[model samples]
Target: MIHSKRSDRNNISPQAGLLIWAIIFLVLATAVLNMPGYPSGLKPATFLKLPLEVPLTGLALLVLSGLAARLLAFFSTLAIGTVLFLRLADIGVQSAFQRRFNPYLDAKMIADGWNVLSGSIGTLTAASLIIATIAVFILVLLLLFTAQVRLADAKPPITGNLRLVFGSLAGVGLIFFTASQFDGMRQYASLQTPSYLTARLTLISKSMDDMRHFDQDLAARAEKTTDEYLFRGVAGRDIILIFIESYGRSAVEDSRYAPLIQPRLASVGDALTAKGFSAASGWTRSPTMGGLSWLAHGTFLSGLWVDNQARYDRLMISDWPSLNSMFRDSGWRTAAVMPAITMAWPEAEYYGYDQIFAAADLGYKGKTFNWVTMPDQYTLSAFDRLVRHPAAEADKPVMAEIALISSHAPWTPVPRLIDWLDVGNGEIFDRQAESGDPPGVVWADDQRIRRQYIQTIDYSLHTVGDYVAKFGDDAVFVVLGDHQPAPLVTGPDASRDVPIHIISRDRNLVRRFEAEGFSPGMIPAEDAANPPMDSMRGKLIRIFSQAQ
Candidate 1:
């Protein structure tokens, strides 16, 4: 009889055992539901408030039984898992693009990100990282599923008092959700998973509607005639539109970078002025901030806001003529020097290039600087030899778009400006490519990354300045930034405005740009009129053509 009494004292009843499992499930659910949407939002206080979904799911499980309860638990777990994954994606997209991820529009970024990752690191390492990320995601889903199943399989049913408690908790959750919508009560509100899901759904719906409107805008732009383009002012000059990667206003305005970058800009501007190259700089708001350079390129060329991948894709298929094509239509040879394009670029046809100098065609014998195929100086040299010099020799004016990528991410082993003659086939840059710290070491510290970024920008700017001073005798150079670097380097609140400099020996051309709101030096005015990038096409055509 004493042994039986001892056994009874130690053993828990079925209801008590299930109650313990339920509590464990509630804790796990609460943690998952309280996960913040941004990396900066992750703090100790983030988990202090309760999540509404936990109590609501518990109440549903309490009310159901058998297959109904099991099905509810399974779907609830799936929903929670999805929320967790999307929240993580949101943090990543916010860091890279300064915006939240849109499932409908941003799916292409996955493949692009993989390419950049494999290029920066090795393909094997990138693949392994992807596999590990997938494994962790799957493990998280499994844990959620197990907890949900345990909650559903509670034995001896919950008591009336517990049911009443769950119902009251669920009601409290609804009240918290309602409070979150009010300005005064929002600070006291708890995290609501349901609200997050609802917001994402709304965002998806809005994205679809936006794409439809974008298609209409593209159609409207495509209906214009080629007769509208007549670039007669300074008709004999070669126009080189050079895009300097990641060259944003922050390079000249941010306190950390300005001290180093502004001095270089002033020196370059002084040298250019002495060489009779008048320059006017201004700010233009790019469609994209951190990455996706093609969007800005398309917007600048097409006179349409190609802000997302969907818009860019649609713009490519439309009948609209790019700036290069407009120049091509008006009796000028057009070419593109794209060092970052390692593979086939069928889009060159759409841009109406008479010749294309891709990465492989550039004849670079040097080692690549991380993701940069070649240094900016080498790229400029190749353009001079392969396209610019040849066109000048033949006396055929050319409108060429040259992409200078030395300032791109993984900004290490920055190449110095060398004499144009020494940049033959790019062999001279091999040693410099191996000089500085690798990306792995540099990226470990934020300050180091910023310094490297500043160095690269300075290098690219000096390269352009020197190249133009030597080779730009009768040419016009419209040098601009593709976009800003990622938020990790520029901080989260950096502007989307990038600096654009029009450098030429023709003072009349510089004066025309000045009349259109550009300031008279390498540094743009602090309050310069920040026009949309898409407006560049119309501005150039109107300013240079007989229409002016």
Candidate 2:
């Protein structure tokens, strides 16, 4: 009786162990499916209907490897953890930009995003999320490793030709299922284990194919681009393109922010009028949202929809002519004033500018406020001193793109505009730089965040207005936002439209925008039809070159 009891207990033990392993596999798979940016229709319940091939195939590989099962498990854990981390990062990119993430291409630009991450580290919201993700990764790996060690010494659950046959069938079925779903299952069950991997793999392959055709596409577009002779309408005019960081349509048109920003908009209008500069405003769709200002900049300059990192990387390598290049080709000096750039930027070479002013070269000795490298006032002041000031004296026409970055993410410790003369190399603003609340404290409340974001936009507008008032007589100003603020401030599903204002002392330059559908002054008309950012290159060329 004791022997029979022992045999029965052994059988039960193997079954229970198999059951536990099955449960663990299911849990891990579900966790990946539920990550942010997952397909909306996918739920935990959907896993109940999924085929058993994925989990079964994993087990088959372990059982077939026999004594090496523990090693296989360790490697499997590493692979799954990496995929999960990628999914999490994609979720973050989607939430902010409303786009899918491509790790294969974006990984190359990790150095570029590092500066952005370092600047915003004080915001516990983003930092904590990253920390929690890494912690989870480590914990999951440890659990899997422990399970492998515990199971490695256990007696074989089953051993026979029958077992091998079952394992082979499971493996073959998994391969066939993944191949079949590679194209047809794009929308449904996309976040499921097999489907998710298949979909991402397909997209990755497509991106590669697109890159192969990128040069041909760019050359075709170049044929329609404005010629060098087209800039004559505005020849000898200093053209300055200013990109206001995170200044979106929501800041100007959303009811939550309009009350705070409208007054400043009105003031900007009054200030420009008082200075004898005519201004017209309208909207344009940005290629990116919340962040990734470079995409928007490239779109406007290259006349291509550089919506992803693959396209962006290609543009950096190609010999495509840009707005800057056009100016360069037309005997005008070109420069890029990028305050957020803290490291070497190879893209500057692609733009073909004569002068480049990054944060390090800007000569600012003030306290860094949150993510903003320097205050917008200081950035504009530096541009004046470095580029515009000398251009005025040398009698040279300059074309420059100045990125004003005070209103960047984690908007806090916003510096108010001071007397331009006192702004002297940005050191004088140290007194007010530490006056506002830190991002960690302010971001704790959503309403306060929204309010502060609006205030930041207001400050940027006033600073630009002040610039035009101080130096409007000799330049044509093209001011626009890079992208909308992150969804947190704009709420969900806000438009990607950003207000663009063209201010100039020449009445003809301002009136020319009217034919292309711009409003009279400072604020774009409520019902004006906004075009995409890529369309601006041709439109500007056509307008300024008299091609219209």
Candidate 3:
């Protein structure tokens, strides 16, 4: 099997030509099938059973495309993508650590957080090594591939590196294509286009204004209604709004999951029933699902309908009075204890808080080297020790912001207990997995996640309730969801609605909600639905003001 022409050996023969073509075909078929695209917005069933038979019709595309002067751009862009994707994972892990530690930047707390973070150095180091290897390998191949090609010598146009050239062309074409999505999104862009962005922002602003007015009016009514709640009135009540991460109405309504949450809430509802607290529920807007806590928080506090980098930048340039400002004006001392917000949340200062306790401000002494700001339980613990304690200026009523981080996703390493750990809190992680749930396959797959999430919410409710109970008849606890959970937990078409619950162990206060049409477990009817990004204070103050 050795006879071959020496001159012809330099060129690829028919057999080699056929083999390369086959290899290229398979690579395109397999790799291209997985390419991300527009996501049709259609269900799997609809795709499979569409009116016509269209296999491989509308789902192939590459993400993060770009244009370059050289032919090596495909491999270069792919290499960049892989690096960025790994970094995103690292970011997520850091977020989880932030959540787990819920560290207040007090020296002691920072020390504790450092200890926990140090434990994850090994993982970070490994990830760095892998990324470095990928970069080096890609760079070497790039140099070789470019060197082998003769850019100047062109006889037969088809004989060159057609794959790299075509891929580059496709990337350039796509960049221009996606930018057009912004054309219709702008105001007064085109007669044929819908200015959806401006319209949504307008509606959001109206909702924010309504809520501010309602809070002021309610505080006035609260002063007149009762003697028990008057340090000055409901304004004097220390508000502890708890936002359970990724919690959905389905978590409590679905029979499959209801058992996990109903018992605890039923008890909570009963306790609040004896007190004068009423509850209601509805929706809010959010940019992302499975993550992105700031989207919900920013939309609620800023009134500017900010869900992306563009809108967020626009808000920073403006000065707006948030709910914090409203409370500050009423003479209640306000403080924001948010660990989730990493960068300087400028709105906090502009809104006029007496004290702003970011993640660093809280004196946390624990370890964390993950994605979130702090575990929900730890967030509650920080609240108990920091804001709920009696202060030297006893007469100054406090309005505190306590954002809960429980039930957030992708629900890993969930906390099982709500014990307050002053020093060794970093050890709190998930329980050992039980491998014997053969019958519970689907349920175990998703339920393990949902179950832990529900448990976290339960712990948050109990802890917050305990703290409020300690505040006695002198305080009013306003605990409401910032927004509904993402669609992954709530279903693809889930509404933005979130439930609001207020509590106080005062009977006269209990009569207030009864006079109005609300109970401890009450949810607002769908008919009363205030659309996306509606002010929660607006919804709450109105009913209580009318009751007074």
By lDDT, who's the top model here? 1
510: Cα error in model 2, Å = 1.9
Number of colliding residue pairs in each model: 0, 1, 35
Residue-level lDDT of model 1, residues 1-548, one tens digit each, is 99999999999987776677667667777777777777778897887667766777777787778899889988988888888788878887888888888888998789887776676555777799889978977877777677667666655446454567667877877787787778767543365567788999899999899989988876764534356457887587899999999999899899999999889989999999999889999999999987789899999998888899988888788778889988888788899999999887777776889999999999999999988989999988889888977644766798999989999887887889887878887888989988988777776788888888889999999999999988898898899998988888788888899999999888888889999999998899899999989898888887778432
TM-score of each: 0.92, 0.81, 0.58
Query: Which stretches in model 2 have alpha-carbon errors above 4 Å?
Result: 1-23, 36-83, 123-132, 142-191, 219-228
**lDDT per model, in order?**
0.84, 0.77, 0.46
Query: Of models 1 and 3, which has the larger TM-score?
Result: 1
- What CA RMSD would candidate 1 show? 3.1
Indicate the residue-level lDDT of 201 in model 2: 86
Q: In candidate 3, what are the lDDT values of residues 436-508, reduced to their tens digit?
A: 2222232346546456556656666665555444344456666656554433345445545555555665545
Which scores higher on TM-score, 2 or 3?
2
TM-score of predicted structure 1? 0.92
Candidate with maximal TM-score: 1
Q: In candidate 2, what are the lDDT values of residues 1-548, reduced to their tens digit?
A: 99999898777566466546545654664455455564432465544333443346345444655557767666666656666776776766655676667866667655545555545546456567667778987887676555554444334543343245446645655666566577764322232555766788898898888877876797565453346666887888899999999999999889999988888988899988998989989999998896888999999998888877778888988878888988888878999999988888888999989999999999999888867779998988888889887644756688999999888867788779888888886778787778877777787888988888888899999999988998767688899998998777887678999999989988887899987899988888889988999998888887788632
Clashes of 1: 0
Off by over 4 Å in 3: 1-11, 14-233, 274-288, 341-347, 367-378, 410-412, 416-447, 470-472, 483-491, 505-530, 540-547
Candidate 1 overall Cα lDDT vs. reference?
0.84
